[model samples]
Target: MIQKETTGMILRKLRGDRTQEEIAAILGITKSSWAMYERDERVPRDEVKIRIANFFGKTVQELFYTPIEHYKCS
Candidate 1:
């Protein structure tokens, strides 16, 4: 099966050479918060998800496809 790319991979590709602070500015969020999302230390809130998708000109699905815990394959 084809594996979906993690949010970090998509973000890294979309952000190109931009720094974390620059991306945070685009999303109107703190750099640490953006870093947390990239590091998978925390999930982004719904509003933040929208901001991320919009900033990168991607649909949320294209940017994030991680299965929730309940949906993980056994």
Candidate 2:
């Protein structure tokens, strides 16, 4: 089935080699918050989403709504 990529996956990919603390500081968020976001344990508010998207130079839709297909073997 096809599923949208989770925000955490997108964040982690965009973050690359950057430290979570560094990204959190740049985005004006706590490292713990960023960690949670990366773990898919929390969702950021719309404003924070916008900030993250802007920091990554991607639109919210591109970052949060992209779809990926994952097939399971029977």
Candidate topping lDDT: 2
What is the Cα root-mean-square deviation between model 2 and the actual structure?
A: 4.8
Top TM-score: which candidate number? Answer: 2
* TM-score (all chains, Cα) for each model: 0.77, 0.79
For candidate 1, lDDT tens digit of each residue in 1-74?
76767888778778789999999997899999988888777888888898899877888877777665456688
Error of 2 at 21 (Å): 0.3
lDDT of 1 at 28: 92
Over the stretch 1-74, how does candidate 2's per-residue lDDT look in tens digits? 55667889889999999999999999999999999999999988889999999998999888767565678999
Per-residue lDDT for 36 in model 1?
82
Q: Which ten residues in a row have the lowest lDDT in candidate 1?
A: 63-72
Candidate 2 residue 41 Cα shift, in angstroms, is 0.7
Clash count, candidate 1: 0
Flag clash pairs in model 2: none
The weakest ten consecutive residues by lDDT in model 2 span 61-70
Q: Cα RMSDs of all predictions? A: 4.3, 4.8
